[model samples]
Target: MAGTPIANSSTKCLPEGMPSIMGAIYPIEIMQDAKRLVVLAEFLSQTRRVHIGEKMPPADDTEPSYNGYSVARWDGDTLVIETSRVRPDVLFFNVPHSINMKITERLRRSSPTLLENKVMIEDPDYLSRPYSFTFQYKKTDYKIGEFVCENNQTKVDAEGKASLQLQPDTK
Candidate 1:
């Protein structure tokens, strides 16, 4: 299946942590200050913190991770962000990224109600060349709500069947 994780007994529909590419696909709320910019996803509740500029140095290669280290700079109306030192813990679809994975993104407001994100991901380990894509979001009056994953809350019964606990309605 194209763009889908490979089907395997050990493969999960989604990994424990947010995949690096999700930053561009999901609905994100961006909060910025003098020092850093925080992008918070409404779905998985993932948060990415990016340094304002080259002021913050990239993380040591020994500290590889999913999101890695992100640094951003403002180019007129566009915010250019570069991330590197990523680990292979998460996959881009079914393809795994190497520690050398690097991502560059351009975020800009297309309109008063529209946000656009152009992203490019590179990883020689799993990709023939860099892949680029763009994702956009239209402003909505909708509010973000709580999203809790029950994957870790699964329990096994005496019969050896796993089940999730259905939370009681608070309303």
Candidate 2:
């Protein structure tokens, strides 16, 4: 049987890495301080941190993770963030990438209430060249809500395909 598609990892309650996490339908909240900033997703309650103006450790010095290691600095009005050392298991958005993937994101306020993130993805092993996309978020008074993916009732067969578990009839 083929391995489970990375796109379905969320069905198994796994963290959906990087750009996919930031590009989700759910709203995200950002909290910042002098040293770092954090992004909090309303979906699955996932959190990501970026150390501002800090040096990123070599891949060998840090563990691979869904969000990887991120370092950032301010470029004029934009905050430039670069992430590397993501796990070989990358984005769950159907697009496949390799272990050498490096992601750069530029975030800025496009309007008084709108924030934009321009993302650039690079992976020579999986992509012919680098590619980019953008995600915009509107400032809202809405509170961030909690979501627990762990409660999903989907069942996976031995082959790694996922399906909804059918409840037995009580009639």
Candidate 3:
């Protein structure tokens, strides 16, 4: 019980961290300092801050949140991040991760202007073995927009049909 607010069976309302984990599939903004790193995604305005060279806190100190408890270390030029304690949430392509799940990400500089993140996901409760993939990001000067998820941003109309605003220009 990591105090993660999951959607109840009766109410399919979006949870507190609805798209935080879901946003993992898209582009991210990486902000790093001497002791920590921040992974930010414009969509849903989700962010995960990883403490560098730090051990996982005591169990009581961690909650099964969207991004889970993440720690990172440098392996030569690459940064290795290990994350656990994620709630049973949709982590990738409609796949849910159990609390026992762990994700290992190896991020390295592919080129002077390109970065790559190779992720490995493991969850015995759902996945057969480990799933691995890589996502790349090109260094850019474009600024991130202010994107936030609003309550009932998506809704079912009177005819009992779900309506989703998919256009990027609309809020």
Candidate 4:
């Protein structure tokens, strides 16, 4: 397990050194059947970005690789997600989360169509603390559209490359 803190940012850019998988995307699909809710998202990569729905806006060129494979199941009203088999190429930009890194997310519906998600990131290779984050989503009635990144283009420079920006320990 790679030890690394999954950086939190309003932007979608992943940290440096973390390779984007082939099909990772946000606003994953949640299918509910009886007591079970299944969530699905593609694992995306720099070389191949998966088209799940409508093409999302291009992330910052300076951003690290984005996207990963994730699935979630509902436990009662709370959603529990387990993410694995992550690509080690860019792990959170440069922090280097291992491919064995495992992430768990807990989600709860704050409203009929709104869900709040709390994510926990764990890795043995790059993190000193377990990273956590929260995100919110609203349900939409629109159908999924074609999302493709083949035409999206950006220029990368040395400064744009993902890297671990560590702060000095205050202790």
Candidate 5:
């Protein structure tokens, strides 16, 4: 459960939005197998995409509408995920990434009580080089509860219009 911090403590910027769902916690029962892991990640990724007002256009249309495409794999006890083809809809620390951006993540279960996640972001459109980050989570015996972001709504005024507040200076 060791790596770089996901966010800069000094800055209060929210990259995607105020209600941005970066990670989740699930019962050990749900993550018992690779198939389950893939299913859970896909489900969560889809949920996040839809939350950001991104849409899946008709297959016939050449233009892209979806924010990002993700694929997951397992490396020993670690789950490696690669995401690309982002639609420049959500901002990273209020800075947007282009459609060519790609992100890689590695999730490892360090112990029965802890899970470690490391994320690498590569976007030539916005960043000078690939930046990596890590996030740690503690396990709990509590059952998984219903988690929803849309239910709790909050608005912020940015550039004279109401918008979701994004975490600032996320690296």
Candidate 6:
């Protein structure tokens, strides 16, 4: 299990992307307006924009990127988001997915302090069929802080284990 590149990108301060971004270890900020919804992640300060009330373009027209092209609409009490053209490598973990991969997320509030997200992932070449899972996030009182990966020094040994090289505060 050593020498694996599971955190390869994160090791270099790259965006974790997609599902990885949804991990609860860090908090994300969501902002909305009449035209688009914006999500800001604590890691790398990554951002994803989901346009509201717009037609999703074919893959041919959507250029692949870390977060992919996304469009959103309201379905009664739920907010539905369709994402496509994500750089296959950034789809799930840092692992690669087929270019045909697609992700759809339906989010609704289960309670005043709880938000539920149902995610469906599809990739004809990588999966036998589509699969889905639901994730629930509870409202927290934590505040977002400035995160700068470069400030943390780290060293990876030959066995692929990474260690933090704690830096003394120069303040």
The best candidate by TM-score is: 2
Ranking of models by lDDT: 2, 6, 3, 1, 5, 4
Determine which window of 10 residues in candidate 2 has minimal summed lDDT. Answer: 1-10
Number of the candidate with higher TM-score, 1 or 2: 2
lDDT of 6 by residue, 1-171 (tens): 565443355775767767666654568877688789887888777888999899899878878887888899999988899887777777355346877778899988999999888999888888888889888888887777777788268766665456666889899
* Predicted candidate 4 versus true structure: per-residue lDDT over 127-160, tens digit per residue: 7778887777778875444443321233233444
Which of the two candidates, 1 or 2, achieves a greater lDDT against the reference?
2
Model 2 lDDT per residue over 1-171, tens place = 365342266777777778778885677898888799899988788999999989888879988888899999999999999998888876546677777899999999999998899999999998888899999988879898898885346776676578666677779
Q: Which of 3 and 6 is the better model by lDDT? A: 6
- TM-score-superior candidate, 3 or 6: 6
lDDT of 6: 0.77
Superposed Cα deviation of residue 145, candidate 1 (Å): 2.3
Q: Where is model 4 poorest over a 10-residue stretch in terms of lDDT?
A: 15-24
How well is each residue in 1-171 modelled by candidate 5, as lDDT tens digits? 253233321122322321123444222222534332422222223332221112334334434333354556667777776666555665555466777677777878888888787888888877899988776777666554443343123343343233344556758
On a 0 to 100 scale, what is the lDDT of residue 137 in model 5? Answer: 70
Give the lowest summed-lDDT range of ten residues in model 5.
9-18
TM-score of 3: 0.75
lDDT score at residue 121, model 3, on the 0-100 scale: 84
Model 4 alpha-carbon drift over 4 Å, by segment:
1-28, 34-74, 93-95, 155-171
Selected candidate, larger lDDT, 3 vs 4: 3
Q: Sorted on TM-score, highest at the top, how do the candidates line up?
A: 2, 6, 3, 1, 5, 4
Runs of candidate 6 exceeding 4 Å displacement: 1-6, 156-171
Q: Candidates' TM-scores?
A: 0.71, 0.87, 0.75, 0.52, 0.56, 0.82
> What are the RMSD figures for all models against the true structure?
6.2, 3.6, 7.9, 13.8, 10.9, 3.3
> Number of clashes in model 1?
0
